[model samples]
Target: MASNKPALEGPVATVAPADNLPYGHGLGESGEAERSWGEWNPTEETVRPVRGRHRVAKQRGLARSSTVLGVGVIAAVGAGGIATAQDKPAVSISLPDVIADNLPDATSLPGMGSSSTAERDTASEVLAQAPLTSAGLTAADSEQGTTAGEALRARILQQAEQQQAEADATQKAATETAAAVEAASQAKKQQTAAEKEAAEAKAKAKAEAEAKAEAERLAKLAASYALPTSSYTITSTFGQAGSLWSSGQHTGLDFAAPTGTPVKAVHSGTVKSAGWSGSYGYRTVLELDDGTEIWYAHQSSMTVTAGQKVSTGDVIGRVGATGNVTGPHLHLEVHTAGGAGVDPMAWLNGKGINP
Candidate 1:
């Protein structure tokens, strides 16, 4: 009989078993399967070469290549997962069926020396690149805040300087105004003082001039007049009340003296009358240059005739007891040009004589 076993280098072929074989063929009498078949007997047909063996080898080789490619993809993904886990926000990751003894320490990985050193290096790299992310945004905000604070400080300083300048200007203006006002007040006071001094000087000069003119007038009047008699006593004054006279008041001034005392002319004048009258025992009337009359009554005797010119101090009559007289006296009377009697004392004072 020919054997149906396929060769190792040939294509595999399907073989049908005999339908007549018992359920427990090639077993022992107890129907147990054989534990061992020591040797196989192959015929010539079992060892024959088969076709399409190269195609089968090629397929198997392609399947093995695909499996190796899948394993490489899985290793690449695991490395990416480790990096992703480090980059994510801190959290716990549980790996199933992974024992602590089977896992490698992160520091023992390739190109990683120690855990603290790697973490420090990673933090330095993150800080260096922080400007591109949210960390960078925080840094930018802080810088802006600092800039704003500096600007505000500068503005405040500028305002303070401006206010100080304005205050200085105001103070300077006030000082200038006060100085001007004080100067003006001083000038006004000096002007007023000068004016007052001038007024006082003018008043003093006017008073001196008036006194000089009065003295010159009195000297001129004194040179033109003289008293009527010397050594005579005034017994009665003009305008005296006396019942002895014909009028109720005496109209002449009386000078009492001894009989025959010489009476002189009071001024240069013409004699208007010199003769005895009823009440006047002896009388004389003298006419002055201005037509005023001077009467010498109660005279003892008359030395001048009517119409005779007499000089001042010339003897015109003698004093004696005359008309209605109690003793010897000279009664002198003055009359104006219109025949009005005047006080002889006042008339003598006007001529610059006291009596």
Candidate 2:
């Protein structure tokens, strides 16, 4: 038969079976089994190998965690890069030559996935390197940005008020100018009316004064004239055609009166003749300062002597039918400047006397 026991590799030791044994419980209990079973015993060598395997598994786990963290950091950097691209200014800005020296570079900042210690140091360096004025400007810019909108609103309102005030001033100036012009026009109109009224009043006073002077002249002329006789009737007018006169037409006015009616001189004059000549019997002739002779013919008697100065209203003769008369009457004739006889009635009317 083939050997049932297998060979041992290294140093081997054997232990005897116990004497008290249960039936069919020894290594030879089942002859058909090809291997023998042994009880486990802890040893330093085996425990040390198990401990090393556990350390290896821990190492693998730490490597996997580190890879995951790196992936997350790369994703964050990619996202930031995309955001920066999207937020880029439409036009690229170039720093001014003066300020370009003060600007910081991008590479000097902490990169993504950098060590925490490096990030903290970089942050501290950046803060320390910043100018004090720049830091203050950052804070001031934030505050000023917040108030800039309010300032703009206040300026807009102020401009609106200023414009409104200007408009009001312009309107007031226009109104005042118009009012002044209207007032001047009104004053001018009033002045014109007053001047016209004054002119009319002056003209009226002149006309009244002329009328009064004319009346006074007429009154003075009336005082110097007189009628030849009173209470007498006119029998014949000058230029009357009658067969009783020597001429074909009557050359004088005849006043029919009673036999002894008085006849007066018509004006202040000298008696040129008082005796009868022939046809003019019992006659009187009065000569005035203007050489106008007034003849009183057909008189019963003559009262004024020849060449005697007679005043107006002096009785020159008595009315009678003494020469070629049909009845008792006075024949009156007027001669101007030694000319032919004129109408005695017309001569009396020229002196403002209605005979």
Candidate 3:
């Protein structure tokens, strides 16, 4: 230790005396360090413990600054100094009262207030109180206490439910479309069937109307004509090939009856002849207005004279065996306007009169 260094000012630390000092060095009265140690030995009894007054000099308002400086000085020392300091008793380091009172609270630091743990917990609680299912959400869910993990679980569930709802809506739309198509098809088919049925019914009604008209025409014709004679049986028809016929084939219809049966005119006409025909015996010939001729042969007597007007159903003669016949009968014949003989039965049918 050197004794030539100048003493520091203000509140210096005091050291205890060495028990065995060199011959010339000693503690001056009033506890003054008179000389520095040259060759001295220290013992437990001679060494005094450092007390409260042993402290660094106060820098007035620069207390915190002085503390910081002291810590810097300790750090600047080399590792050997640190090892020597380790051999000493452990020392307690504390901030000055005035410096600690002037420091700000830890919670007031930047990034520590708004982003505090209390705020984080409140956010987690809000999320956790939300409904777990996406099907619905209501304001009342917040009444329940909540947790962070539950909030996350609720969010996942809500997303899954939303996706499922979308899928269900899409499927429902598709099903409705299919149903609409089916209904339209069915309606179209029914309409077509109805149209076809209506067409068939119209055709049937038209055919029935035509048939009724034809029947009315036949009825009118039947009223205008009549059978030649009553109580008579058809014996032979025109075009009958037999040995008894003079022309090799019969040219008339034979109506067989008892002698003196009355014969009537078939239609309104004038008598053309009332005299005897050679093979026809006593015959009567009547000519219609259209030049068609009707002959009544094999008659016993004639009531219509030549050029006499006779109406339909007027008595004209009597059936007899006068013609070339084996029994009493009237031979009736029909001739077209050209004098061509036709079947009498067919001619009568054409007039709507069937014998």
Best by lDDT: 3
Residue-wise C-alpha lDDT for candidate 1, range 1-355, written one tens digit per residue: 1122232421122211222124745465765434322112223443344465522221222123433323333444444522333333443323223233344554454445576687788999987754433332345556665444445566689899999999999999999999999999999898888888888888878877886776677666666677777678988888889798888888988888889889999889999999988787788999999999998988988889999999878999899887879999988899999999999988987887676
Q: Each model's TM-score, in the order given?
A: 0.50, 0.47, 0.55
lDDT score for candidate 3 against the true structure: 0.73
**Rank by lDDT, descending?**
3, 1, 2
Tens digit of per-residue lDDT, candidate 2, span 1-355: 1112121122211111332223423445453212221211123432233222233111222123434333333444444522322333333323234344433443433352346568788889997765433322344556766344455566689899999999999999999999999999999999999999999999989889987886676567667878888788988899999787778899988888898899998889998888877987788888999999988898999887988998888888888888788889888899989687888888877677776
lDDT (CA) per prediction:
0.69, 0.67, 0.73
- After superposition, the stretches of candidate 1 with alpha carbons farther than 4 Å from their true spots are 1-201
Better of 2 and 3 by TM-score: 3
The alpha-carbon lDDT assigned to residue 180 of candidate 2 equals: 99
What residue runs in model 3 are displaced by over 4 Å at the alpha carbon?
1-182, 246-248
Q: What is the lDDT of candidate 2?
A: 0.67
Could you list the CA RMSD of all candidates, in the order they appear?
A: 21.9, 25.1, 15.8
- Candidate 3, 1-355: lDDT as tens digits: 1112122222212232333233424558754435433211223443345544543343323433644433333333322323333444444445456555655554554345756777788879987875555433334434454444565578789889999999999999999999999999999999999999999999989999987987788788888899999898898988999889977899999898899999999999999999889889999999999999999998999887999999989999998888577999999999989999999999999888999
Candidate 1 residue pairs in clash (backbone atoms < 3 Å)? none
Clashes found in each candidate (C-alpha, N, C closer than 3 A): 0, 0, 0
